[model samples]
Target chain A: MNKMQQRLLHPSKATRQDRFGKTISLICIGFIMILTVSIIGFIAIHGLATFFENHVSVMQFIFSSNWNPGQLGKNGQPQVGAFAMIVASFAVTLLAAILATPFAIAVALYMTELAPKRGAKMLQPVIELLVGIPSVVYGFIGLVVIVPAIRSVFGGTGFGILAGSIVLFVMILPTITSLTIDSLQQVPDHYRKASLALGATKWQTIYKVILRAALPGILTAIVFGMARAFGEALAVQMVIGNAALTPTSLTSPTATLTSQLTSQMGDTIMGTLPNNALWSLALVLLIMSVIFNLLIKVVGKRGEMKK
Target chain B: MTTNETVITTKDVRLYYGEHEALHGINLDFQKSQITALIGPSGCGKSTYLRCLNRMNDLIHDVTITGSFKIDGHDIYRPQQDVVSLRKKVGMVFQQPNPFPFSVYDNVAYGLRVQGIKDKKIISQKVEESLKQAAVWDEVKDDLTKNALSFSGGQQQRICIARLLAVKPDVILLDEPTSALDPISSAKIEEMLLQIKDQYTIIIVTHSMQQASRISDKTAFMLNGDLVEYGDTKKIFLNPEQEATSDYLNGKFG
Candidate 1:
């Protein structure tokens, strides 16, 4: 073969660089996969230890509200029930999502349809700034302002599911709003024009056509916001009162899985039941996050299929 | 069929998009129950002018319009003229077959439902009649609940026409409704327009000269934001008054 033909057919400097680039990317991905798998595996092993090694039945761990892991209950079973925390987590996440969704949709509509220039130039940056603010700052604000506000209104220590939901509402508002704006923008402009051309009023077109077309995407956005609210640690912990009790009312003290885990993780001995219980909580959080991710994927796939 | 009865009259209509004038003082009168074709090259403001008739251009920001637009001798641009009702009297179909990502039944009944007609029986009856009027009933009769976007482009376009017909507007403005379709679909739409011409005043913006001559009762040729020629389709095609009209018709230049 000629020199040029041989260079084209065989490994050259460019080919070496290509292989090197591929190897580097592959190594990076491999490292990430290993890190992720090991993290999940570590959490899983320790989390299952509560039921396996400690002999805590899954039903007692999940359904029993008596969560005193350091001692045995009257029934001779370990009191490691996560029912309250699970309920509180769901309550806070759902309340926050419900409180935030309408506001997010309104802001997104204002940005995408009503006043795009003002939204892009003014509101977009403000929302991005809200997202950039550290979660600790949000926690601090919740602790000082929201707690006292609730105390004055509801006659409590001001630390409860209400305060936590309010804090999470603020925290996840920007996330939901930005994602909602993206979904609203994804709706084809032709839909708007078609609706308007049919003699539909602007409000009718927005509600009937634009919002309907963006339903799945908006649902995905709300789910993502719920995920953020569910997994949040520091902010929710500060406002949620850190009480290991069942929430009876909106203004009552409660403990979410994340808040409980964060509060108890540092205090427990390394190999104790308390520590294993915290790991179990972490496992719940991990599973919930996976479920959230799957929900987003399913929603996105359903939206595409409808299209 | 030249008629003395004018349905829509626009005298000296000018439109500007952020200081860039798109339509320059266009004056035209559309007759009642007649198909008028506006033929032009791209960016000649044909679609822009059509949008003005129904005040659809009001949706765009930084758009300044100056002129008098009257429908049935009532000034439609008046401050008290209620754009919503004006649009009900004047409907538009776009170049793309834009059906709401909904069922065919919902898509056709959308206009009626917008007017707050909540009776299901009336809505279904109107939807069926509109679909049949638009010549798409036979194809979509079995799949009324199927999503309109799931259909082929041609069927989707027909569904859009049905949507427009469901509103029962006196004037129908189509902005190159067949430009995005194949020849057979275009022919179908042309035939459907001809069938409905006696019921509504139809104004179409088209690039195909053959389409204009084949379907339009009167053809108006526009160039560079100016109405260059306006007359009978046969006269404009066979014996032209302006040099530019013949030139464009012969494919000499756009």
Candidate 2:
């Protein structure tokens, strides 16, 4: 082969650089994957230890509200049932998502359709700022304002699922609104034009056409918000009044899985049943988040199929 | 042709997009139940003039329009004029086939539903009639529940036309509707337009001179936002009055 052909076939400096860049990115991705797998694996091993090694019944761990993991019950089983915390977590997450969805959709519509200029210049930054605010600040606000407000109005202790839901509603509102804005913006400009050219009123166009087309995207946004609400720890921990008891009313004291994990993780000894029980709670949270992610993917896929 | 009752009349219609003037004093009238073609080079404001007829330009920002646009002897630009009802009276089919990402049945019934017609029997009847009129009912009749976006481009365009026809508009403005389609699909659209021209006043913007000569009864040649020549399609295609029009037809310059 000629020297020119040899040089062309061999790796040049640019080709070498490209290989190096690819290797670097591959290494970074490998590191992230390893970290994610190890963390999940570690949590799963410890989480399962509570049931397998400690001889706790899986049914009792899930359905029983008796959560004294350090002690044994009359049945000689570890009292580590987490049914109350599970219920509390789902209740707060669902209520917060329901409360925030309408408000988020409304704000998103105003930003994208009604007053786009003012919405972009004035409201977008504000919503982004809300997102950037630390979760601790939200918790602090809830502890002082919402808890006291609920106390006066509803006439109870005010630190309960209701308080957590209200705080979560505020925290997830910006997330849902910003994501909803993105989905609404993803709707093609031609759709709006088509509806208007049909002689439909502005309200009808937005309501019937735009919203229906963006339905899957909007549902995905709400699921994302729900995921954030489900996994949030500190803000919900502060206001949920961590009692480890099954809540009978919105105003009664309750504890979520995350709150219990945060409050008790430090106190339990490593390798003990108490600590392993906390791991089980963590496992539940991890699984729920994975489900949320899967939900987003399914919704996104359905939206694409419609196109 | 001149004695026929006019469905749409525009006098001295000038449009500005921000600081840029797009349409300069366009004076034209479309005859009732006749096909009038607007032929021009790219960006000569044919689509802009078409949009003005239905007040579709109001959706754009920083657009200033002056002069009069009257449809069926009613001033459409009047402040108290209901733009929605005006648009209902004059429907539009766009350059791109834009059916809502919905079932065929829903897409065709959208206009009637918007008009607050709730009777299922009437909506189904209108949907079928319009789809047949647009010459696509035979292809899509069994699959009305299927998504409209799943169809081929030609079929989608026909469905869009069907969607427009369901409203029973008096005037139909087509803005280069066939410019994006294949020759076969374009032929189908031309045939469909000829079939429906007797019932609706049809104004079309076309880049294809052959299409203009083939389907249009009257053709208006526009150059740089000015109406250069307006006459019978046969006369315009056979013997032109203006040098620019002759040059454009003879492929001298766009």
Candidate 3:
């Protein structure tokens, strides 16, 4: 056969629709890559400008606690260190993780392993509705119910770090639980049967076999939930009192980087040191989110390697 | 012909899934301390019957069983018979190797620990003994800390068998234990079964007729939940009284 004949014979192998579909998908992927790179580049450049152009020392910015964007520091420099806000962000997110993990795991286990199929199917959508609630709605609840309750019980000033952490805890609970259930469900049935057939009870099979297999996925869920809690601003801000000072106790008011940015960004003029410092805060948050997400991929790879 | 002791006895066994009946009136006696191979085509209820022996079918929902199943004259279908203790006496291995996501030592030790054995030294000894009996101790002795899944497919399957052996059950039911393995691995398993048949009553559900002839002392042929023939391995393969059994062995059709 001639080359032309051979080529004509296999037209359906890579048809016009196939090529078109491939081209369109490649273009979509390229668009997303370009968007991500440009946005990250913009944040990096604008965020670093606060330190480079305004003559703020990197070490001073990292270690110093003062964050008064309106006031000048010693030698007539704008006070731009965000040490207190960073600590508050981490502390509140850690507290939320500690509060949410046990409940999420319990719910996930009940849904995936213990509950009847009909019950699990019914409970899944209802529990997932918690994630659909708006952050503003959660903020309102924290403002109206949780903050006051904390004040009455713990003798606090009502608006405090504890309030913020509690609100974040509620916000991340559904995210972790739903993802954990999915991960647990991904474990093959044969492992459970193998354990059970060996005379191990159902609870034993869950902890020793099913849970061990689903651990990487559970860790990924937690990392994603923690990232969401760390990035949450609106709800945490409403209950965290928006204070800029360092918190001495759980009852003491505090400020996160997001809360500070939201409060000061509207009034601060562009190209000023205050606006630049706000950009720096966004930069830090962006980096942390990316790192947390990357950690999931690393964990998945290690899990596969072990297997 | 019936001089050997019976380890498992089932009469008028009927299994149902919700409303549909899958197995209908299976009656047979499995021989004690010997390999009994149940051979037939797919969807023939061989595996379902195997699972029924140890109540593994209870894991599925809406499964109702009515029959008299007994091991050493103890009625297994009775409500008072605890499923956990029943399973302890009759262990099982699956078609696929399903070791827990733990080290090799832990996989072998899982059964004893389930029985609440707390002594680490005793667990270590039994783990070694079970691995040796399964003929995998030499290959894994230096690497007991390695994950069981990190081993080859055949090694993983042997480890699963070793896990079952560690429990020291009176009976072991295998659901096509070598179907997922290569030819060499399948032969290894067949040879291992030959060596261990004197101590454990093993009931295996197999698709390959040759494997049944190679390892089993007694053969039970099933066709869509009906036992067509049950006799010595040599008699069933060479002079089956039923036409369907001979047809299946000759490969006329599954």
Candidate 4:
């Protein structure tokens, strides 16, 4: 009777606990929303301020390659076109994605599908170790080793789009590979069995069935890799020569939006037109990454739908 | 049923997953153009036996199988045997309806394409014929472009059969093909199997005793990694020579 009577007292306690849980979760979600909204809102306002303060046309900023920020006597008229930076950023990111995707897929398939249990266990930690190594270390390696190798091979200053692409490729390899492994591992074993039962070879089963089934996940991985490549500043800036010009060849030096903003942020005075332009660049970078993130969601959601 | 020719014969077959032996010296034979239903309790090696027909069990790690599995006098388990070609002769359908997440046409065309049959007309004709043979052609012919996964469970299972049939395998192994389906779908599959048994050797692993009695010409009862009984389905169901087989059929104990 005592235990039963005590059980009667549990409803209110459970309700209170439920309320607390709900409140905490709501607060956490609200906090994230507020932070993201404030950050994007601030960037948008400052980015548009460049056009508002200096009579700089948005079209010119996006299209014109000339980017000489005027000082004294030129007043607010700053040559702030970032078209070259946009092209360079895209070229570097695309090149990195192209370089990393096939290797990532191959490594992922070998690790998750083909490797023995013990070998895979040993290799997994090594791959994760690669991921844990700071991006700056990769940058250092690129500047020291990759740049020189490029110079010896391709015969150029070597601190160019290709160097940046290689460094970004190495930096994003672990990210893409791990994500691909995760996606490949998620496919049910039944898919492989079905394909193999149809007399398809193991490799055929992997590429035709397993890879097709895991496509959306792999796409999400590549998008994440590309986003990282696009948003990367420190590593790419260090290896790239940071010349504010469009790259005509792989060996030609070019500056990405990230590189330009990172380089000029400290040089510009507070509330100056150049400072607003930098903010505008930051906004562009943010927009690019957010678009990729959205693409990830779209791809993941489609995968879930298929499942 | 026809000429008493053994399409599949296994001699002193033993399968081990690492240290544990799952099949203990299994010796079984199946006839050409007949249905052989494998009946057993769970984990009794019936599914494992079915998989051994196409060497599907080879996909698992730490599986050490010492056995001579021969199909039509060709040693299937021999190292020299090409698994791809062997599987082309022995297709398999899993317990669940595992249609690839493509259109119905593409799902049926998968095996042919894997064999490098690239002519669009050949693929289209084979896909249509296989779908018709699987008895789902009328329902899906209007929507060959529709996603295979969008079909009902039973229809998806039939599509998988069509996929296997597209390659024209000599033997089709079905592992509990109708277990996940409704009774009507199960009946449809049973009827379809009965019709197709004239052309292809059928090996099915089933949990249902009634299904075994209804569809199979020969039934093999496996009990704890051993072949407890293997005989004509009627005799095995009604007057089994083994006590364990009768006990299981009588629902006394598994």
Candidate 5:
């Protein structure tokens, strides 16, 4: 009788255990959100303070083609202009994304649609391995292999904007292609069937139905790949032929924001104008990354709504 | 639209999916401008035979077919035959409502666009005519640009039928087109089928005895992948000759 009464009072131990399980899940989610908020808050506070404290005009900071913030007026104070770095950085990233996107899409299509199943299974792992390699190694290879080859072809020293773009392109190809394949594969088979059933040829079905249906996903993949390429510093610095000015042509040396930071950070005084400029550039890069990430998220959300 | 006009004839048709036989040497004739119903339980191969009409099974892996099937005197399975052209002549509606993820108007115009008909006027006219024929024009006329996925299940099924009708195919295949709809929707589809039969030779696969008896002029009953009995719909339902057919229709056994 005593044991029966104890069982009734305890009921099941599972009730408390389930509550504990749910609590753990909430805690994990809260930790991630807190971490993201802390990082964003830190960047905004520190980065925004530098821009406001300098008393420099935002228009000159953005539109000026030269960044020489160290040499001052008749007083000989430091003056720096950041326009060259911003323009060169965007040019390099856009060129690389444009060069790589088509090849990535083609490779993804071949892997998912054209290759036999057995061959595809064998190749997928090897292609995915490209994403795991360190960026520094790719930089070294770009310095040795890609730079000299371009110099020979262009008939000059090849460490320039074109060389840097080529290296970034090669680095981002695998990311775009793999994501593209995933999106293409996610398109419903019914769309393909309906297209074919309407007397459209195989190529027609892919072009008209399958690709169109997955267009948002493909666009998101390209945006993510471009974001990765844009942020790549080590590889671009190794081959960009940093000349501290905006590039005039593919053969001319140029310095992106990352190269500028790498060049001026440790060698210069900690609180100098160049150092402050590096922080500003970092903030700009952060803003670009957030914007692109938001685009990817919105596109993904749209894909879900369609499904 | 003569009653004696024949649109498709299958002679000793046999179909296999990999190592398993799904249809075993079934002979049947589908009349032009009339509705023919193929009724059977699940796995009886009625759907498989419907797919055979347009060579849809060719899309599947490890599917083998051995038979003589003709649509307007053209052997569909012959090496020289083009499956695309054959399919254009014989449109199909699936068991599930599968309107393309497009605008309601675009769903009806998909067939014409694929056939390279670019005149907007012709497309709009045909879209309206097809939707009216499917009895969905009144519901969707105000929202032609809205996505087809926004429609109700019954509306989507009707939109699919409208899609099939826009191609002006000589024959249309329905694989339980209304099975996914509610009772009211199913009745609407049945009424539409009766109206469209005069212009298109229609072959329907159904499990409902009442639907078969109500709309079909000729009925074929299949069991265990074999055609057990086929005759006038009235005879098949009221006076089936084969014991298996009688037992199946009487609900004695599947």
Candidate 6:
């Protein structure tokens, strides 16, 4: 058909709807992109000078892990060391994630598959309530309860990386369990039924088919959980004892970048250096979180595409 | 015909999904070494009846079935009955191609593996024999290691058949196995069904009147969850005893 005839036959209303939908969606996406760029620009503008300053070497900052630097020469003042803080942060986060994973999966499984209707109805609200509780309360509990318990067992030093990890583990449990339950629930009912119908036992059906199919989603949940654990701040500070020295064990006094930044921000001598370091630490933390989230999304999307 | 050779029989069976009754006290006999086709419209309970033969309907929550369903002269609905063995003896193929996401050989070997038959030689032999019986060995033999989902729609359906056959079930239940396939695929499935009828009792539920006439030795016409007529396939197709059955066969109504 000729162009004019085709235009008349097709009608402009359909094309107009498609164009309008595209324009509206583009506007929404553009708004979010602009907001992100603006925030990143602000952080980079304030912190770009630190990257160039000879006062702090990049290798010394990352590799040596000695965070404290002097306003004068090495002979004039003692430099604050950060090796302990970095190691303590990673050690505590790893411990928390490992301790919480199995319990989270069991809670998720019970919530999704085995719990009775009334029990699920009651447990769901309680689990969701855990999410809304303020982080400070969990920290307070760690101070009053977990610290003392550890002290009683490990000679009464109530503050350390272990205490901080226990607190953070409790704080992030709800997030991991809820995400796991969502992933398990999304597995197709037919896969379960088909497995069961093939004369496989109930546990076999879940392990061989349900869990196999839901692996990507479960892995995503774990990565997100680890990301949350590594970035937690106020709660970690309260239980970690905030010592500037490196911790040799879970019970040893130490500090995280967050706690160090908070403590040093108040000192008059530390000034903008501590604040600048905090921003840099935040950039590192942000990059790590994004990497993990991207990993989860990529794996989950691949699984969905295969299906 | 020997009465002792029957594969599956139901006596005044009643099935209810919640308060609503689906099957209204139906009695039927599924014979050995023959093809029995149940033809009816959607929601006429044909598929439900087929699931009942293998006790698959028991999986539905809040469903209650009364009366006796027996296979090899044993009551399948008995409280003490072992559903695992029952399912192994009476395998089912679904309306859609529901092949497991695995290699073609693995799909065929799924049943054997579930039964704890771990010998590598036995599994390989059974997988090949089952694929051959389903008439898909030659087409898939070269690519047995490839994912079953890579196959065409017809080939996937046949792979499902091969999977079920590897279980060595005495009775095979098919629910509109070819309704999802094209005409050529449907014809291939019909021919394969005819070839395998001698080794196993085959009960197929179909919507197509022509398929029922072509492949079935015995045909049962059903409407609204009740059997209207049942007899030899040739007699039912050409001269049905009931007016409703004839009307359905003649394309007057379904």
Would you estimate the TM-scores of all the predictions? Answer: 0.97, 0.98, 0.95, 0.94, 0.94, 0.89
Using DockQ as the measure, name the better of candidate 2 and candidate 6.
2
List each model's interface RMSD: 0.7, 0.6, 1.2, 0.8, 1.1, 1.7
TM-score of 4: 0.94
Candidate achieving higher DockQ, 2 or 4: 2
Ranking by lDDT: 2, 1, 4, 3, 5, 6
Question: Just chain B of model 2: what TM-score?
Answer: 0.98
Residue A253 displacement in candidate 3 (angstroms): 0.7
Candidate 3 lDDT tens digits, A121-158 = 88778777888899999999999999899899888678
Write down the lDDT of every candidate, Cα atoms only: 0.93, 0.94, 0.89, 0.90, 0.85, 0.80
lDDT of 5 by residue, A19-101 (tens): 89999999999999999898877767655544677655667667765567665644453345567788888888889889988
Winner on DockQ between 1 and 2 is: 2
- Candidate order, TM-score descending: 2, 1, 3, 4, 5, 6
Candidate 1: regions farther than 4 A off: B1-4
Model 6 over residues B1-254: C-alpha lDDT tens digits? 54436778898877899999898878888888899999987898989988888788977889888888888889998889888888888888888887766689887888888889999999999999999989899999999998887899999989989988888889999999999999998999999999988889999999998999899989988788787787889999888888888777777875
TM-score of chain B of each: 0.98, 0.98, 0.98, 0.98, 0.98, 0.97
Instruction: Tell me how far the alpha carbon of residue B228 in candidate 6 is from the true structure, in angstroms, after superposition.
Output: 2.0
lDDT of 1 by residue, A171-273 (tens): 9999999999999999999999999888898899999999999999999999999999999989999998989898889888889999999898888998799
Score residue A103 of candidate 1 by CA lDDT: 96
Candidate 1 has an lDDT of 0.93
True contacts kept of 6: 0.31
Kindly indicate the candidate among 3 and 5 with the higher DockQ. Answer: 3
Poorest 10 consecutive residues by lDDT, candidate 2 chain B: B1-10
Task: Judge candidate 6 at residue A271 and give its lDDT.
Answer: 33
- Residue B167 error for model 3, in Å? 0.9
Classify candidate 5 by CAPRI docking class: medium
Model 1, range B64-167, lDDT digits (tens) per residue?
A: 99989989999998889888999999999999999999999999999999999999999999999999999999999999999999998999999999999999
Candidate 2 pairs with clashing backbones: none
For every model in order, the fraction of real contacts preserved is: 0.83, 0.86, 0.86, 0.83, 0.55, 0.31
Separate DockQ for every predicted complex: 0.86, 0.90, 0.75, 0.84, 0.68, 0.43
C-alpha positional error of residue A61 in candidate 5 after TM-score superposition, expressed in Å: 2.3
